[model samples]
Target: MEDEVLLTLMIEDLLAAEGFDTISAAHETEAMAHAAAAADRIAVAVVNLHLGRDVAGQRVIRALRQHVPNLPVVVITGFDSEAPQADLRGLGGPTVRLHKPGGYDELVPAVLNVMKQVRTGAWPEEGRRKTDYNV
Candidate 1:
């Protein structure tokens, strides 16, 4: 949970209560490091999309996936409109993007669903497509 304020703390607390081992990071560097070190050990990642101007959490997702490509990343968005959902979904990984203010109950199920999909090898591979776009 590498977020500055608001939902990060709440989500972390929720995860802890659910009996999951958790860690926190407030920026990109720390998040990447944590993900790398916690690879295989971490079953799921609950990431917030807007992690400052540079899309830091997106970087974390890429790096973590490089380490564990099949890793399930549950993207959290605070946007009021549905526009970001499409963009977030196209991030090309095993993911679930939820719009807020989504409750902890909803959050936990979303996280657990992705984790279940991952554990059962039921998730779709990121860039696999039927129609290839050749340059």
Candidate 2:
């Protein structure tokens, strides 16, 4: 889920152009609602790590994981998903992160990468780095 309207619209249009059925959510509650309604159809999720001032996207990710245990996540954030000295490893399932502002081209690839990991059962591997979120 992304809080930025322009970015969300850009992403929605871009993904739609690529023939993806898009679902957009701006915050935790909306994310949960959409996930609940379309969990089975949601093949992957692209979330903004900070929805507004809080790291609410993390909550969305966790909730999505609880709902769809092995759901692949594509986390887009301005800061590092693996911040220095930060520890949030059990964040759940196959995941990916892409630095924001100019990584539009990487979106599809990152999503595809995580989906492949799910398909091949390669994620949640031991000793994998946190930034290993993205391909």
Candidate 3:
């Protein structure tokens, strides 16, 4: 999920073109609704660190996980450092991170790679890249 409408749509289209369906949400409720509604269908999640101006980003991840246990997450942020969002680290299951403006180049691979890792149960410790953001 991403807060900016255009970026959310862009990411949706990018994934759609790659033959993946996406649920785009900018707030925790919308994300939870999607996760609860399509728990079995969701294969992975690419979440924006700052979901919206009022939402706590970590809440979004937590909500998603409540429905989909061990859900592979590709956490994305625009910040250069992750010191402020230290809570995002050590989130359960296999999570991977990427910094914007990585564009689709970095996103597609991260999404696919994380899903592959989770499915095979071989998420590399080396892929644990993190960054910071706020809501």
lDDT of 2: 0.78
Mind giving the per-residue lDDT tens digits that candidate 2 earns over 33-116? 997888878888998877866677777877777778888888887876467412335676687767887777799888889999
Candidate 1 lDDT over residue span 100-126, tens digit each? 575455888888888888778786556
In model 3, what lDDT does residue 127 have? 38
Model 3 bad stretches (over 4 Å): 127-135
Model 1 gets an lDDT of 0.69
Cα error of candidate 2 at position 81, Å: 3.9
Better of 2 and 3 by lDDT: 2
Candidate 3 global CA lDDT score: 0.76
The top-ranked prediction according to lDDT is 2
Record all residue pairs in model 3 with backbone atoms less than 3 Å apart, i.e. clashing.
none
Candidate 1 stretches with Cα past 4 Å from truth are 80-86, 89-91, 124-135
Which 10 consecutive positions of candidate 1 have the poorest summed lDDT? 126-135
